[model samples]
Target: MYALIVIISIIFFISCLLFLDYQLGKRNHIKNLRFLDFEPTTGDYNLYTNGDQLFTDLFDDLRHAKKQINVMFFIVKDDDISHELLELLKKKAQEGLRVRLMVDRIGSFRINKATVKQLEQAGIEFTFSSTPKFPFLYYRIQRRNHRKITIIDDEIGYVGGFNMGQEYLGRDAELGNWRDYHLRLIGDVVKDLQITFFDDWYLNTGESYDHIPEPTSEGSKEVEITSTDGGQLEDVFMTLIQQAQDEIFIGTPYFIPSERLMKALLSAMDRGVDVKVIVPMKADHLFVKEAGLPYLSRVRKAGGEVYFFDLGFYHAKVIIIDQELCDIGTANFDRRSLFLNKEVNTLIFNKRFVMDLRLAYLRDVQDSQPFDDHYTQLFNLGTKIRIGLAYLVRPLL
Candidate 1:
């Protein structure tokens, strides 16, 4: 009895310490939040669903870069394709062009010290973003820079879900036929992308560039770049949902939304909006799919459609509303994206672009299976327990 009492006391004391840490972390995060809302700019944009095509165009742009190249990604795996990209950047840097590469410290943990030395030797500037520090260690560890963007010569930009990996090129045996959405852009929006990249670079390196090129219209399509550092994302998503009058379509690898965002989605359905969501049938992370089960079930019950994409690992982060405006970028429709990560998304306000994206969404849906009652009924005792745990620690997911 004495030993048992001591163990209980220890557990209670550790739990209280953790609770205090969490509260302090929350306060610190709110105090340092940053959000940016760029004005709508005219730009020419091409959406790439094929990874091969995207990298081909991107590599070509890198090769043609005249003055500078800035690249950032959440993950840059130590794989064949990543090596190819690093080599290209090294060549560019050696040619006296400014080259900077930034990757998330945690997401790209596979990038070792030897690679950093190689990059530096080649005159390429490299740094890791969102490295965990003191103050709020636990909270800081959870906060990631989830934005994936590239700017070349302050004229061309690439943004979307594609990271530098062979898996992204549909070579992973476990996740076959990788499907995602990415954008290649030119014109005024490229300047916005550069500004976003500069902001992140400044945060990590304390280096700032003063020669941001002036905006020039390249196309008629209107676009707004929204960057968030664990702030204002929920409100942005809520406003997008609340303004929908005809339909809503979302595609994400994770679906664990905040309570308010979920409620707004359901309310959109209640008001006659045709709401649809697509998620992966296979989970890449632990407890993520299970966490979304309850929310997906509720969406189905409320006449909103849910799809499980079985063709491949669906990693597209997109939302289309009323075939009028759409969001596409690194932000997932999950709590981590909506409340914790540093993310960037493009709000495109062109009907033609929206319809094109909507068509692609439907194509993906046709390749998916419905999230019906039978699907929910397939959960067993273990899965149900995981679902409960997922809810208990959802903010961290």
Candidate 2:
């Protein structure tokens, strides 16, 4: 019994030490790789607000795709956009386009394999990313390819928080007023997106970037691809959050920011910079909503203003600073988005995009509702206590 107890204690001590070492290594890695090399003096970039025109552009790129079409998404539901895009993809595949797609085994949960089998039968290659379809064992399979990305003909790329969903496009009656931003990328940066796509594709299909992403003289002069976070890579978005100066404005449907981000925001506020945040009045996730309230309350007390868009559930993720730096992609502020989910975000240091985003801020402000402490007044002590405790595990959200 004594020997067994000692062995157990030894194992526990080693585990704790390993975890601490991992955390320290992660911190150092983040410090080293988070800030991507963006030439502040390079490129004239444009930003897109609505999905209609962006979808048209995406379609145009697909129509032009001759050699390859690579796409990877967390979720591909049976929405109008998905169907239309799939039909277009099928047509291209029929026309001898080397079309390939990767869907998350975890996120493409509700979607049936039969839905995509037709494309496979039509010669379009398809694969699933880290799919776990078990019972209690499935819960442990938490890491996911949460990125929503599409690369057309290896030239044009798309990334943002807007998944191929009706709610994201704000067309469905159920989602009357969701707001999101996606970049229609056409540049060398598309290579980064393609690299990301290839990485996910190979994780499932064993195909390299050479097989999926063909080199071309054609690249987007406007922007380049920057990563948010990959499995063990530093979260570039978090680094960007820390780089805020003069002004900081964020619009994310899920607003559960990490403690590091929260501290940065509060510190920025403390510096007297005008900071404004917008989130959904009604998030699609219930536990997230409950968890987010306490943070908002804390933020409000810290001289920050929180606006909740009541028109509908807004799924947009944007962060603009000083009308100079802007990023629009499918990343949210929460831990699931930042650390666990396979998310992507681009950094655009273009004056034009930032200026236009300022305008978007105006439109979003017009449509959003303000959140006050009044909503929490009805909550009793027990509920408040639960919310406070829920935040302790925010790192795992």
Candidate 3:
């Protein structure tokens, strides 16, 4: 019995040591791979706000994809737009073009098995990222691919907030006029997008291409693609907040923020930077919105402005700083996006592009209402309790 107790104690001690090591490693991981980890290269970027026009451009580009097509999305519903895109992929596959599609299991949970099989039969390769492992269900739920990426022949790419749902194209009655931002990318940065897709693809399907096609230099817009497979995105954002000079504008559907991010935002405001955050008036997820309120409340108290988008379900994950730096991609302003989900964002350091994005944000602001102390009174006791509960599981959200 004494020997048994000693053996168990030794195992417990070793486990504790390993846990401490993991915590320490995770804390320092961002330091090891800072903003400079991903080098900025010259690229041409176009900001697309109209969902109709964005999809039109995407379909047109995909129709012309001669060599290969790669797409990764968090949500790929069985709606008209999704089916249309799938048919296009099928056509490309039948034309001897290598077409690959990946969707997150949870995000695309509603996607029919019949559609997947049809795509497979049509020669289009498809896979689900972070599919559930029965015994490890919690683990599966925590890590998901939330990136919306499409790369064509390794030259052209698209990355941003719009998923494959018809509502994303502004068609839903409940969430009318879906407002979002997607980027049409060309040049050196496209290679990075392709590599990020390749990483998720290989993890899901155990397949990889021979080489990442050599990036062609097209324009002089300097950009860097930062990605986190459940890791460093929040750290990068914190760094960006810390470095902001004059003004910061952030637009996202959900607004839950980490403590570190909250502190950074308050600190930026304290330093005299004009900080404004825009979120959707009609939130798709109430629990998430409620959980975000306390943070927004704190931001308001610190002299930062929080606006509720009144026009539509504003689903844009973007940030513009001092009209000099701009970032847009799949990540949201929530804990799920920061540390739990596989996400990507492109940071562009071009005054011209930043000015365009800033203009777009201002247009959104016109359609939003200031969320002040009065908005806080709208949350009843039950909602406040739910928000408290949601906050506890935020890291796992």
Model 1: which ten-residue window has the lowest total lDDT? 211-220
Residues 291-331 of candidate 1 have per-residue lDDT tens digits of 99999999999999999999989999999999999999999
What TM-score, over all chains together, does every model reach? 0.97, 0.81, 0.89
lDDT by residue (91-160, candidate 2, tens digit) is 8999998898787876777567687688888888988886654332322255567788887766677787
Q: Whose TM-score is greatest here?
A: 1
TM-score attained by model 3:
0.89
Residue 207 in candidate 1, Cα distance off native in Å: 1.3
Q: Candidate 2: list runs displaced more than 4 Å.
A: 1-46, 133-140, 211-224, 230-238, 373-389, 392-396
lDDT of 1 at 391: 91
User: Candidate 1: where is the Cα deviation over 4 Å?
Assistant: 1-12, 215-217
Residue 345: error of model 2 in Å?
0.9
Candidate 3: C-alpha lDDT: 0.84
- Superposed on all Cα atoms, the candidates' RMSDs to the truth, in angstroms, are 1.5, 5.9, 5.8
